[model samples]
Target: MRQAMYGLVLYVFLMLPPVANLAESVMTIHMHMQMPLFVIAGMLMTPFLKQQFPRFFAKWNSNGVPGIILFMIVVIYWMIPRTMDEALTIQAIEIFKFISLPFLAGVPLRDSWKKIRLVGKNIIFVTLSVICGFMAWLYIFSPEQLCNNYLIVEQITLGWAFLFLALSIMIYFVQQFFVDRSECE
Candidate 1:
């Protein structure tokens, strides 16, 4: 209950014009920071939502794969450069962005993460890393600006950000192979 209230507060705060404007002013902040924050707010409220609609989650996501896949699809959709532009230009798309990122992507992600096996989790992580790597290459190497709203320099910065994220994921994967769970525990 308390967590849900906190999430609601975050949701409301992020919706504020000043905050939203500042976040959206920067390309990287809009995509990487603000978007993720919305999803996180939803994740924080998952406990209450899960308790309220137990059957919906269970019936639709018995093994967690379905929910996670939905999460990935929603997230990937938002990652598209054109979608970001549409969200800024079109009011309906903006509203959908605010609503969909939280409910569509975040809720299922939190629900599915706990239920999915470790191998499943690893696969998702690796897939995201690969996607990030691809996006980085696309943004960095493209001669033209990818987003109309942002300059080429900002686009390059976002590409570097994606590169760092991909590299970090790869580093984590490498570390996992060397770490002995028995020793740590």
Candidate 2:
């Protein structure tokens, strides 16, 4: 409950005009910071939601595939450059961004993650890594501006951010490969 309250407070803080403007001012910040924070806030609310809507969640999520699909769809939509631009320019899109990122994407993601098999989890990681790499390549090398609201340099920075994310995921996998579980035991 306390955590949920904190999440709600954080969400409110992010929604403040100055804070929102600052976060949206840079492409990298908007994508990496604001977007993930929204997701985190939603994740924090998951416990309460599960408790309140156990039957509904269980019926809809079932084996978690449906919820995971919904989460992925929302994530993919937000990843598009046009969607980001529209979120900034269009009131409806902005509202949707605020609502969907948390309720639709984050909440479902938290619920699904626990239910998915190990193979399914790995698939998600690989899919995200590929997406990050592809987006990095597109943003870094494209001659044309992908988003009208941001400058070329900002796009390049976002590309680097994506590249860094991809690298981080790779590093995690490598670490997992070499970890000495036997020694720990």
Candidate 3:
């Protein structure tokens, strides 16, 4: 299970740069279609994940640590002014959806040796991939149209995405060091 998760993470990271470049070249309509397909793929994987990783689910059921942290971050950000501005707020919401990918993907591996480490690593890589993809898209397409009336939401969302990615990377490295030290001791 750990190997599989690690493989998936590597695969996603490797594929992202090319995918982003391809997305930049493709017609806007085609890109739009592809984005939702990725979402569908995630949704479809849920059942298989549950069947394969019952132990992880058990861990998730026993602990609310991840969810609680996510909630607190959201709430704290909400309290800050300008965060609620339309564009940034929408971006923040979009970022939340992106971050969900790791939690959902990692939920099935909670009790395994990799445990949260696997999740953290995968999340960090995936988030970085996404940010890179977006940067590519923004640079190439430069779509002037705002999906929402407020542009602040998009800024907030980007900020949140970076924060999540950084936090995940930090946790992953810290856990890895501890695990390595424990084994040595």
Candidate 4:
């Protein structure tokens, strides 16, 4: 209950014009921070949601893969430059961004994560890293602005951000692999 309230508060704060405007002003912040914050808020609210709709999850996302897949789809959709532009311009899309990130992606992800095996988790991480790398390459190399709301420079910055993220993920996985191998010896 307390966590859910906190999540609600976070959702409200993020929705506030000044904060929203600030986050949306930067291409990287808009995609990486503001968008994920919605997912995090939903993550925080998962316990309450799970309690409220136990049967629904059991029936639809029994193994968790479906839920994670759905979450991934939502995330991948938002990563598109056009989708980000639509979020800024279309009220309906913006609203969907708010609702879908948390409820559709976040909640399900939290529930599904526990059910996923180590290999599955790694697969997800690898996929995300590839996505980041691809986005980075596109952003950095493209001469034209992919998102109308942002400048080309901002797009480049976002590209750098994506590159950094991909590298970080790769580093973490490599470190984990080494540690696991050492432990087995």
Index of the highest-TM-score prediction: 1
User: TM-score for model 1?
Assistant: 0.95
Residue 80 in candidate 4, Cα distance off native in Å: 0.4
- Candidate 1 lDDT by residue in tens digits, 94-173: 99999999888889999999999999989998999999999999888989988889999998889999999899999997
Task: Estimate the lDDT of model 2.
Answer: 0.90
Local accuracy of candidate 2 as per-residue lDDT tens digits, 5-87: 88789878888889999999999999999999999999988888899899999999988899898988998899999999999
TM-score result, candidate 3: 0.26
Off by over 4 Å in 1: 181-185
Q: Rate the local accuracy (lDDT) of all candidates.
A: 0.92, 0.90, 0.43, 0.92
Work out the TM-score per prediction.
0.95, 0.94, 0.26, 0.94
Per-residue lDDT of model 3, residues 11-112, tens digit only:
354236465345423333112333333333443444457577767656754454453344334333432323333313465553553344333433322322
lDDT value, candidate 3, whole model: 0.43
In the predicted model 4, the residue pairs found to clash are none
* C-alpha lDDT of candidate 1 relative to the true structure: 0.92
Ordered list by lDDT, greatest first: 4, 1, 2, 3
